[model samples]
Target: MIGIVYITAGSMENASEIARELVVRRLAACVNMFPTFSIYRWEEKVEEQNEIVLLVKTDSSRLDEIIGTVKHLHTYSLPAIEFWEVKGEEEYLDWVHVNSS
Candidate 1:
């Protein structure tokens, strides 16, 4: 199975660092990062801030490792890390599995 992990980082540099680590460790086949504005409740207060979103593509089997890595590298005490099982083109899915494995 293939999966896409959605995570948010404090900045582009942080996002890049996490992305590089994931790729180097073969936990992710590819990572796409972009700037985003986020609003959420924290500590009983609503907050708004700018953030970088990281989209990680990988084999679903690697999700546990990916989560651990992200937790270790992420700056936030509680980072937003979510994922969903996804279906893409066959060749792409194969490529992701090979690279991540």
Candidate 2:
């Protein structure tokens, strides 16, 4: 199992849209969305804003397909998408593998 983190705009509508697509397509076992704050510079202008963060759980082998789909569907030209290798207790990992598969 693998845990993927994605940062999207603060819009619930956008988060919901992404969540639905990933889950329905079986690319993700579960997606957890929570509020987050982001500070960055764009187009030579600095900006600070609240954002929605998504924690997507899926099988490790499916990461590429999922990423490709996101790149194709994401509104932003360079969406912040990353994956964290989940190295933890065996039981939890097993559960994630089961659920994602």
Candidate 3:
């Protein structure tokens, strides 16, 4: 089965760098970027910020490696990294699994 991971980079440059590495290392089949506005509580204070959201596509087998790679390249002490299993059509999941390699 395949899955989709969501991660946010500290900046555009970092996002691009990580995306390239993921693809080169065969950790992800694709990485998409979109403008994002986030509002959340940090350090007991609510803050709003503009950021770039990365939609990462890869097989489940590569999940841990991909996460580790992101953590290593990420700037924040704690980066926003989350994954959601792809409960989609069979064909699509297979495609993700195939291309991720």
Candidate 4:
């Protein structure tokens, strides 16, 4: 199966660094990052901030390693990380599995 991991970072540099690490370690096949704004409750107060989002594509088998690497490399004390199984083109999914492996 395929998996997509969603993560948010404080800055473009941070996001890029995390993406690079994941790709280099073969934990992710590819990472797409973009700037976004987030509004959420933290410390019992609503907070809004500009952030970078990373969309990580990989094989489901690598999900645990991806999460561990992100936690080790992420700057935030509590980074936003989520993952879900997905379906996609067969060829593309095969490529993801090959690269992640």
Candidate 5:
């Protein structure tokens, strides 16, 4: 199965670093990032901040390793990591599987 993982970083630099590591390790096929404003409750207080969001494409088999790598490299005490099953063009999905392997 293919998985699309989502993660947010405090800065573009951090996001790029994480993406590079993942791709280099073959844990992710590709990573797309963009800056956005995030509003959420933390420490019992609502806070809003600008953050970079990463969209990682990889194989489900490597999900655990990808998460661990992100945690190891992330700057956040508790980074937000989420994944969803995705269906798309067969060629694209196959590409993700081959690259992520």
Candidate 6:
């Protein structure tokens, strides 16, 4: 099974750092980062902010390790980490499975 993990970082630097580490550790096959605007309720107040979003590709089996690494390296008290099962081209999914292992 392939998983697409979504993580929001405070800045581009943080996003890049996380992406690099994940790839280096073979926990993620690829990570795409982009600027995004996020709006959500926190502490009973609605807040909006600019953030960097990371789209991470990996095998579902690696999800736990990926989440742990992100939590360890993340600066936020509560970072956004979410994932969902994904279906992609066979070759690509196979590549992800191989690399993520």
* Clashing residue pairs in candidate 1 (N, C-alpha, C atoms within 3 angstroms): none
Ranking by lDDT: 5, 6, 1, 4, 3, 2
Candidate 2's residue-wise lDDT over 1-101, tens digit each? 56665647457677778777888888887889988888999889998988788888777887887788777777678778888877777877666667666
> Which candidate achieves the best TM-score against the true structure?
5
Tens digit per residue, CA lDDT, model 1, 8-100:
999898899999999999999999999999999999999999999999999889889999999999999998889889988999899999999
Off by over 4 Å in 1: none
Decoy 4 TM-score against native: 0.96
Model 6 C-alpha RMSD to native: 0.7
- TM-score of candidate 2 on Cα atoms, chains taken together: 0.82
Which regions of candidate 6 are displaced past 4 Å?
A: none
What local lDDT score does residue 47 receive in model 3, on the 0 to 100 scale? Answer: 82
Candidate 5 vs candidate 6: the lDDT winner is: 5
Q: Can you list the residue pairs that collide in candidate 3?
A: none
lDDT of 1 at 70: 93
lDDT string for model 3 (1-101, tens) is 57788998768998898889998898888999988888988899998888888999998889889989999998877888888887888887777778787
User: What value of lDDT does candidate 2 attain over all alpha carbons?
Assistant: 0.76
Q: Alpha-carbon error at 6 in model 4, in Å? A: 0.3
Show the lowest summed lDDT stretch of 10 residues, model 3.
Answer: 92-101
**Which of the two, 3 or 4, has more lDDT?**
4
Best by lDDT: 5
Off by over 4 Å in 2: none
